[model samples]
Target chain A: MQKVVRMDDMNGVASGFPKTAGAQAVVEITDLSLVYQTADHPVTALANVNLTINKGDFVSFIGPSGCGKTTLMRVVADLEHPTAGTALVNGGSPEQARRDRAYGYVFQAPTLYPWRSVARNVMLPLEIMGLPKADQRERARAALELVGLTGFERKYPWQLSGGMQQRVSIARALSFDPDLLLMDEPFGALDEITRDRLNDELLSLWKKTHKTVIFVTHSISEAVYLSTKIVIMSARPGRIIDIIDSPLPRDRSAETRDSQAFLDVAHRVRQGLLAGHGKDD
Target chain B: MARMIRPPAILTRALPLLFVLAVLAVAWLGGAVWLNAPQIIDRWQRDGKTDYSTGELVTAAWSQERPLLPAPQQIYADLAKSFSGRLDSPRNLLFHTWVTGSAMASGFGLGVLLGGILALGIVHVRTLEKSLMPWVIASQTVPILAIAPMIVVVLGNIGLTGLLPKAVIAMYLCFFPITIGLVKGLRSPDPLQLDLMRTYSASPIQLFWKLRWPAAMPFLFTSLKVAISIALVGAIVGELPTGAQAGLGARLLAGSYYGQTIQIWSALVVSAVLGMGLVGLIGLVERITLRYQAVPKAAGGRG
Candidate 1:
C-alpha cells in the first residue's frame, strides 16, 4: 500500500505531538458497539468495531442492508450512541466534536430546505454558526463553485435534476469547511450514470480539499474506486470483517478501475463480504 | 391556418363559478314564486275574486309585500337601498356588517395570537402537548350555540359588554383550527431534516424560525381560511344572545320581528359576502407568503 503524507500529519510529526494525543488520526474507534433497545429484544447494531481513519484519508464503509457501517459513522457524527467502548473524532468525544463543528454530515437524502435557494441552502450552517452576511455569501459562492454549481445558486432545489441536487448538498456540507465529512449513501438515490459521475466528482473534490471522509455505501465498485481505505462490515450484530488499504496511486481516473490492482482489491472485498454473509447463513 | 382562440385564464377559472351562480339564480326565482303563490291565492280566495290567471298570481307572488321567501330582485333592491345610504346609518347593511366585521377581525387577531402561543407551547414542551392538548380538543366539543348565551351573560355581568363579548366568542371559535394546524405544521419537518439541523448545532429558536415555521406556512394559511369564516359565524352567534341593536344578527332579529323576510334575506346575503371577502383576503396573503414553495400540491393539506 502506498502511504500518502498528509499536511496535518506532517505538521503533527514535525511539532513532536505525542501518539496518545491522536494527532494524525481524524477518527479513532476502539471496541465500539451499539445496541438498539426494541420492543421485542435488544438489537446489536455494532459489535466490537475497531478502526482508525487518518487525516486526508478517503474511507468508505461497504456492507449490505442492516449492517452497522452507517451506525459506526453515526457514532462518529454523534447521531448515535455506542453501548460499549469508545468512538473519537479529532481526538475528542463525538458530542464535543459535533458541538465544535469539526465535521459536516450529508444524509441519504439531499435534505435541502425547499424554501431556501441553492446558495441559501449552502449558507444554512454558516448562518447557524453566526457568520457575518458578507462572509456567508462569499463562502457560499466559493463552495457552490467547488461543486460545479456556481450558476445554479439562485435556483431552488426542486428546479434542479436529482444529480444536481445531491451536488448542491455536497456544496452545503463543504460550505462550512469542516475538517471531516460524513456522507451516508448520498448518491444511492441517483441513477447509475449520475452515480458514476458523482463518484468521480467526489474523488476529485476529496483530492482538491484533502478533507478526511467517512462514506457509507452498499456498492462494492464505488467503494473500490473512491476509497483509500475500505471497511467491510457484516449484518445481524454488525462488525468489521476486513479493512483493505489500496495500493493504487494517489491520483486516479476512470481508467484506474480497469487495472489489475483495482480488480485484485475488489476481489478481496467481494470475498470478505461473502465470508461475512457465510457466517449468518 | 387559423389559430384557435382560447379563453383567458381568469375567465376560464371563473366560468365554472359563473355557471353555478346562474343555475342557483334560476332555482331561487322558481322557489320564490312557488313559496309565495299559496299566500297570494289565499288572499284572492278570501276576497271572493274567482277570476285569477296563473300569470297574474305569479306576478303578485313575485311582488308580495311580505313573501315567505323574497325574490332575488327584492333582496337586491333592499341591498342597493342599504348601500346607497350613509355607511354610518343604522339602517344600512354595511353599517351592521362593519360592526360584526370589526368584532370578527379583532377576535381573529386575538385567536391567531393565542393559537400561535398554544402551538408553540405544545410543540416545544412534551408535558404541555400531553396535558393541554386533550383539554384544547375537548374545549371545541362543547357547542358554541349552547355556550354563547352564557358567555354573553357572564361577560356582561363582569361589565364586558357588546363588542368584547362578541369578539371573545369569535376568538373562541377561530383559535382551535389555528392551534391544531400550527401544531401539525411545527412538527411537519422530516426527521432527516431535523437531524441535519442538529448537525449544525442549531438552537431551538433557530430550528423553529429557520425550518419548522417556514414548513408550517401552508398549514397556517389553510387553517386561517377556515378560522376567518368561523370567526364571522362566531361574531353573528355572539350577537344573537345579546340582542344588541347593531350587527347582522340584530338585523335578522329585527327583520323577523317585523315579518320583513326581504330584510332578513338581504342581511344573510351581506354576511355571506363578508365571509367570502375574508377568505379571499387570506388566500391573497397565502400566495404572497408561500410564493417560494414549488407547487400548490405540496401545500395541499396538513401533510
Candidate 2:
C-alpha cells in the first residue's frame, strides 16, 4: 500500500516548505540533544535532532515508546533543557518564548483541578496571565464554546466523561490564545471511538484557529490523519529516522481515512518505524 | 419476586453506631457494679446488717455515695445539675467549658498561622525541609505532659498568666500536625500540573494563591480536625499543673480531692463531647468549602 514518495534525506535536519507562502518558522531546532544523567549511566533522550515547524502547521512526532517524541516537544516548550545545541521558539530562545507565554501545553492526562468548575479550570491560565476578571470569563466562555462544551460550564471535572474532560483541557489550552500548542498524546488514554471523534474535532479546531501544534503520539493512523508533516523517530539514543510531508487534502473527515493517499502515508510511516526498530538490533 | 423495603439512608448509617454505643453503655454499667460492690459489702458488714439480699446489694452498689466507680446515671444526674444552674455561674459546666474552649480556640488559631508559614517555607525552600523538619518532629516527641507545666511556669513568671499561657501549650501541641499536613497538601499538585503552571509563566505568588493554596484546602481541614482535638487536650493539661481555678481541669482536680467520682466523670464526659463538637464543626466547614470535590467517583451524580 506504500507509495514511492521521495523521503527527505536524514542530514540531521528536516525542513518542509510552508503551506502558506510567507509563513514564518514557529519552531527551529539545531542539532539539539538531551542526556539524562541517571545514577548508573547517562541516558540519551534526543540526539542531534534538527527540524523546523512553520506557522499554521499541524506537526505530529510519531515513534515507539521512549523515542523522545514527547521529550523533543518538551524541549521546545522549555519544560526540559537540551544538554547540547539549541532550540528556538518564535525566533527567540525557548526560555524566553515560554516567559512571553508563546505556547500552551496539554499533558496526556486532563490535569484539571478537582476543586475548580469547568469554566474556572479553563480560566486558570488567563487568571495567571493577569487578565481582567471580565475578560477571563469572556475568553473562557468562547474557548469552551469552541470545544462544544458550552452547557457544561458549572460541572466539575469528575462529573464529565474522559473524552469530555480531555476536550475541556483543550479548551483550557486555547483559553490564553497562544500561537503554539504542544499536546503530548492528549487522547492517548481515550478509547478508539472517542479518539477518532477527537481527531476530527482537533482538525477542525486547528483549521479555525490556525495555531501551530506539535502533537506527540504512537499511533500511525492518527499521525497520518491529523498532521501536515510527520516526524518518525527511533529509541536507544532517540533520533528522527524519517520526515514525511503528507499529500492528503487540507480538510479531512471520517471518510478520509479510507482514501488511498491516507493508507499510503500510513504504510510509509509503518515502514519508517520498522526501519528505526531494525537499527536497534 | 417481592420487592424488599430498604431502610432510610440515615437509619442505615446510624444503626451500627447506635449498636456500638449500646454495647458501651452496658459494659460501663457492669464495670460500675463490679468496682463498687466490694466497698458496699464492707459498709454493710460494718453497719451490722446481716440479711441484705443480692438484689438489694446490687442496687446499693450502684447508688452508694463516694463509690469507687460512679454509675453512668450518677454522672448523668451531676451533669443535669450543672446544666440546670445559671450558665455563667462557677457551678455551671458551661462556665468551665467556656474557659477551656477559649484557650483551645486561641491556641488553634496560633497553631494554624505558624503551621501555614512553616509549610510554605518548607515547600519553597529546600533548606527549610532539610534543616527544620527534623526539629519539628523532635519537638513533638517531647511529651506534652512533661512540657506543659514548664511552659506555664515560664510564661507565668514573665507575667503572661491566664488563657495566654494555656494557649501557648495548646499551640505547642497542635502546630506539628498542621505543618506536616500543609506541607504535603501544598506539594500535592502533580508534576504535570506544576509544569502546566510553568507554561503559563506564573509567578511564585500567583502559583501559591491560585494552585497550591486551593489544592491544600482538603489537607488543611483534615489536619485542623486533629490539631483542634489535641489543642483541647493541651489546654486541659495546662490547667492541671497550675491548679488554675474555673476550668474543666480544675474541676477534675477538685472532684478527685473531695472523692467526688460523679463530678469527675461529668467533667470527663463534657470534655469528650466538646472535642467531638470541635471536630464536627471542622468537618462541616470542609464540606461547605470542598463541595465541588464531593463526587470522587466519575460516575457519581453531578453536584
Candidate 3:
C-alpha cells in the first residue's frame, strides 16, 4: 500500500477540514464476534475477525450482504456492540471512544433531518457534543461548501435531490472534525451517474481531509477505485478472507477505474468475493 | 435542457381558486332569487290581493324574509351591527357578556392543555398508548349529546360548575385527534435518521429535541385546527344545559325557546366565524414554520 505518512502533505481532501493526527492506529478490531438474538434463534452475524486501521488511510470492507461489513462498521461506531472479543478506537474501548466523540458514521441513506435545513442538519453532531455555537456555525458552513452545497444551507433535505442529500450527509460527517469516518454503502442507493459523481467527490474529500476512513461497500470496482486497502470477507458468520493492498496512485481521478492497474485490483477482489461466497453452506 | 430547467410560474395555481369563487357567486345569486320569490307573492296576497306594481314588486323582493333560508343581506346587516357596536351596546341585543367569553376562553385553554399533555404522555410511553388509545377512540364513537348532560349534572353536583365543567366537555371531545396526530408525528423520523443519531451517541432527550420535535410541527398544527373546531362545539353544548349565561350558545337556546329564528341563525353564524378564526390563527403559524421547510418551486437549486 502507498502509505500517506505526512499530515502536512494531505492537502485538498476537504475544504478547511483538519488533517488526522497521524501518529496512531485510530481503529483496531481484535477477534470481534456479533450475534443477534431473535425470538426463535440467535443468529451469529460476525465471527473472530481482526483488523487494524491506521490514521489517514482510506480502507474499505467489501463482501456480500450477510458478510458483516456493515455489522463491523456499526460495532466500530458503537451503534452496536460485538458479542465477543473486542474493538478499540485510539487505545480506548468503542464505548469510551463514542463518549469522546471519536468518529462519524454515514449510512446507505442520506438520513438528513427533514425539518432541518442542510446547514443545520450538518451542525447536529456539534450541537449534540455541546460545542460553542459560533464554532458549530463555522464548521457547518465550511462542510456544506466543501460538498459543493454552498448555496443550499437553508434548504430542507426533501427539497434536495437524492445525490445532494447524500452529499449533505457526507458534509455532516465531516462537520464535527472527527478522526475517523465510518460509511456503510453510502452511495448504494444512488443511480449510476450520480454514484460515479459522488465517488469522485468522496475521493477528493478523503484526499483533502486525510481522516482515517473505513468504508463498507459490496461493489468490487468501487472498492478498488477508492481504498488504499480492501478487506474481503466471507458471508454468513462473516470472517475476513483477505486484506489486499492496492497499487493505484494516491492522486485518483474518474479515469482511475478504467486503468489497467485498477482493473487488476478489481478482478482480484471479485475473485475473492466469489471464493468466499459459499462458506456458510 | 430548457424543458428540464423550467422557468418559474404563478399563473397555474391562481386559476383554480378563481374558478371556485366564480362558481360560489353564481350559486349564491340563484339561491337568493329562489328564496325571495315565494315570500314576495305571499306579502302581496296578504295585503289585499292587488296586482303588484313594479315599485311594489321591487320593494317586496328586497324586503321579503324566509325563516328557513334567511336573506344573505340580513345576515350581513346583523354581522355589521354586531361589529359596529350597535348590537353590543348594553341597551341593545348583543352586550359583551364577560360570563360567556370567559367560559369559552377557559374551556378552550383547558382542552388544549389537556390534549397536549395526553399526547406527550402517549407518545413517550408505550403502555399508556396501548391502554388509552382504544378508549379514546371509543369515547368519540358515543354521541356527544348523550355524554353532555351526564358531564354537566355530575360535575355540577361535585361543585365544579363553571369553568372546569365546560373545559372538561371541550377536552372530552377535542383530545383524540390531537393525540393521534401527535403520536404519528413524534414517530415520524426515518430509520436512518435514528441510526445517525445513535452513531453520535445521542441521548433520547437529544434525539427528541433535535429531530422529533421539529418533525412534529406540521402534524401538531393540523391537529390543532381540528381540536379548535371541536372545542367550540363542546363550549356551545356546555352552554345548552344552562341558558343563564350571555353566550352565543345561551342566545341560541333563548331564540329556540321564544321561536325567534333570526336570533338563533345569527348566533350560529357567530359560532362558525369564531371557530374559523381560531383555526385560521393556528394555520397562519403553520405557514410561517413550514416556509422554512419548503423550497420555492420556481427556484430549483441543489443542496
Candidate 4:
C-alpha cells in the first residue's frame, strides 16, 4: 500500500508542507479543536485536527453528517472561531486573511440574491472590494464565461435551473479571483448528473486557475474523484480518522474510475468510513 | 396561433375587477331605490301626492333633494359639476382634493423615509430590535380613531395647524407598516447569502445597500401600498377632528351639516378615487425601482 502511494515531487506532502522552506502552503492547522456550546450540552465539532493545504491542491474533507468537515471549512473561512489551538491562513489569523479577501466561499445552496442578475451576482465580491464598475463588468463576464454561463449574465437566479444556479454561484466565487476557495457541500443539493458534470468542470476550473480548493462533502466517490488529498473525519467529537493522498496521475479521464489505482483509493476511503461508523456502532 | 389569440396581461387582470364593478353598480342602484322609496312616498304624501306609483316613487327617490342613500348617478353628476368648475373655487372637488392629497403625499413621503431609517437601525442594532420593536408593535394596537382627536389637539396646542398636523398623522399611521415590513425585509437574506457577503469583507453599509436593502424591495413596496392608502385615511381623519374648512373630510362635514347625502357620498367616492391614484403612483415607482430585477427572458436564457 505504501509502495502504491508514490509521493510525486513531494508537492502533495500533507503534514510536513509548511516546515519545508519557501512552500506556498495556503492553510496551516495545528491541533485545532472547536467546541460549540448548545443550550443543553457542549458539542465538540472538531478535536485535535492538524492539516496543511498547499496552493493549487484539490483537498476534500469526507465524513458523516454530524462530523466537523464543514466546521473545519468554516473555521478556515473565518466564519467560525476555534475553541483551542492555532489555525492560520497565509501565515496570518483567519480573521485578517478574510479581511484581506484571501478566499471565496460557496455554500451548500446557490445562495445568489434572487433580485440580482447573474453578472451582478458574480460582481458582488468585486463591488465589495471597491473595484471600479468597468473592471467589475469585465471580471464578472470573464468568470461567467469560464463557468459556461456567458449568455445567462442578465438572467436572474430563479430563471436558472438548480445546476445552472450552482454554476453561477461558482462563477460568483471565482469572479474576484481569490487565491483560496472554500466550498461546503456545494454539490450536495444537485442531482447526480449535474453534480458529475460540475465535478468535471470544477476540475478543469482548478487546472486553469490553479487555485487551492478545500471541499467538504458526504459523497466518498466525489471526494476520491476530485481530491489530491482526502481527509476522512468521524462524528461525535469529530476528528480526522485518516488522510489518503491520491496516487492517481495528474491527467485523469472518466475511464480513470475503473482503473486499479482508483479502485484501490476508493476501497481505502470506504474502509476508513466503515472504520469510523464502527466506532459509533 | 395561441400567441395571437391570447389577451393582453393587463386586460386579463382588469376583467375580474370590471365584472365586480358592474355587479356593484347594479347593487348600488337597486339599494338606492329600495332604501329611499319609502321616504320619497312619505314626502309626496305630505305634499298631497298620495297616488304615486312604485316607478314614480323610485324616480323621485333617485332624484330626491336630500336622499337617504344617494343614487350613484347623482353622486357622479355632483362630481362632474364640482370637477368642471374653477380649480381654486371651493365648489370644485379638485380644490378640496388637492388640499387633502397634498397633505397625504407629504405625509407618505415622510413616513417612508422615517420608516426606512428606523428599520435600518433596528436591523443593524440587535438591542434596538429587542427594545424598540415591541413599542412599534404596541403603538399600532392603539386604535387610530381613538387617538386621532388627541393627536390633533396636542399638535394644535403647539400651533402646528393645517397640513403639518395631518401629515404627522399620516406619518404616524404609515410608518408602522413600513417599519415592520422593512425590518422583515432587510433581514430577509438567507444565512447563506449573509455569509457570502461576509466572505467578501463587505462593510455593514455595503451589506445593507447592496444585499439587505435590495432583498427588502418587494417587502418595502408591499408595505408602501398599505401605508399610502392608510396615510390618505390619516390625512382625512386629521381634517375631521380639527374641523378644517378644506379636504374630503371637510367636504363630508359640510355635506352632513346641510343634510346633503349626495354631497357626502360624492366626497367619499372622490376620496376613494384619490386613494387609488396615490397607491397607483406608488406602484409605478415600485415597478421602476425593481425593473432591473425582472428576469431576462431571452430565448437562450435558462428557464
Every model's TM-score: 0.93, 0.95, 0.83, 0.92
Q: Which stretches of candidate 2 lie over 4 Å from their true place?
A: A1-21, B1-10, B296-303
- Which candidate number maximizes TM-score? 2
Candidates' C-alpha lDDT: 0.90, 0.90, 0.78, 0.87
Which 10 residues in a row give candidate 2 chain A its minimum summed lDDT?
A: A1-10
Lowest summed lDDT across 10 adjacent residues in model 3 chain B is found at: B90-99
Candidate 3: lDDT of A153? Answer: 88
Which residue runs of candidate 4 sit more than 4 Å off their true CA positions? A1-23, B1-15, B292-303
lDDT of 4 by residue, B79-184 (tens): 9999899999999989999999999999999999989888988988889988998888888899887888898889889898899888988889999999999999
- Local accuracy of candidate 1 as per-residue lDDT tens digits, A152-219: 88998888988899999999999999989999999999999999999989999999999999999999
Q: In candidate 1, which residue ranges exceed 4 Å CA deviation?
A: A1-23, B1-14, B296-303
Model 3 lDDT at residue B274? 76
Compare the candidates by DockQ and give the number of the best one. Answer: 2
What digit string (tens of lDDT, one per residue) describes model 3 on residues A153-191? Answer: 888887889999999998999998888998999999889
Deviation (Å) of A22 in candidate 2: 3.7
RMSD of each: 5.0, 4.0, 7.2, 4.6
Q: State the lDDT at B69 in candidate 4.
A: 89
lDDT of 2 at B273: 99
Arranged by TM-score, best first: 2, 1, 4, 3
Please provide, for model 3 over B1-303, each residue's C-alpha lDDT reduced to its tens digit, 9 standing for 90 to 100.
456754445555677888997887667545655666676677667987767676665445544443445555666676666667755563233452334445666766776677678778888888998888888789999998888888989988988786666677787888777878888888888877788888788999998898888888888889989987887788778778854356667777887887656667777777787778788998998988777655566456443
